[model samples]
Target: MAQAADAEGTVVVTTTAEGGRAGARALATAVRDQLPADRPGVVAVGAESGGGAVIVIAVNTAARTAGQDASTLVKHLLHGRGGGSPELAQGGGLPTGQLADTLAAVPGMFTAG
Candidate 1:
């Protein structure tokens, strides 16, 4: 897995799996549960597989206080490609090799949004 953490408490993680969507989902969930909760921020996680790619965005309580909604922001960023609740969202079928670039852009997402 590749992970990046920002000063704002946002984290972006990427991984590759042989199982595709299922594997991506599992990893995203695991990472979300492992993130620190001292501050609110976005957890932007992704996984790429033979079939396609998966992106999941999760948020903590502090993020809410900052008016940051990971799900909504992700959907907007991906042009309405994903689906999820206010706190969590998932999108996939991105072009192969796009996960890394996308994850790298996540840090700027909060401030830009």
Candidate 2:
């Protein structure tokens, strides 16, 4: 199991790539632009297995408020990677753990697009 925790309250999101490399950093920058100017966010490069990237993202204060679990949220982002390509991945940590570490394992999630 991996670890991914935010500051008290933060929005965490993950995404798995279909091929090539991790795209978390790029996605993070994109997502950041869409968020409120006052909010802080962080994106981490997860892992890469079977040709896809797992991008993990954390939103400040809003994501947690919407009943989102770091683990599940990150998992959701890696839903597809070819029929059972596997690479059974994880996003969140042991509830109150480090979120970045977990995401770092997910392929190219941390690459610069």
Candidate 3:
């Protein structure tokens, strides 16, 4: 798993999984569920699929307070198509190699957005 704190002090947690969409979403949900309720956080889980990868994200209430939208983040940063509520989102058709790098860059992207 990878963890970083965004400019707003929202913890961003990310990880990779072997399974596809279902697996990534499951892992993301697991990680998001583990975060303390009082803390602001985001969880991202990526998994390889076909020749690319899919990313799943979950945002907590505290994180949403800053107007964090997982769907928008993935679509903008990864150039992939996806949609979900501000609290949960998933996107796919991204370069598999870029998964980690993109996840790592998430915190910094928050500032730019």
Top-lDDT structure, candidate number: 3
What is the per-residue lDDT of model 3 for residues 1-113, given as tens digits with 9 covering 90 to 100?
66656556778887888789889888888888888777788888889988898888898887788777888877776675887878889888789888888777777865654
Select the stronger candidate by TM-score from 1 and 3.
Answer: 3
Ranking of all candidate structures by their lDDT, best first: 3, 1, 2
lDDT (Cα, tens digit) per residue for candidate 2, span 1-113 = 32333433343334433232335434544554555544333333444534333444444334334443334435554443211112112332222233344454433432345
Let me know the TM-score candidate 2 reaches against the reference structure.
0.32
- Comparing candidate 1 with candidate 2, which one achieves the higher TM-score? 1
lDDT of 1 by residue, 55-107 (tens): 77777666767677767877876778887877778888777678778777777
- For model 3, where is the 10-residue window of minimal lDDT? 1-10
State candidate 3's TM-score: 0.86
Error of 3 at 24 (Å): 0.6
TM per candidate: 0.76, 0.32, 0.86
- The full ranking of all candidates by TM-score, starting with the best, is 3, 1, 2
Q: Per model, state how many residue pairs clash.
A: 2, 23, 0
Could you tell me the lDDT of residue 35 within candidate 1?
66
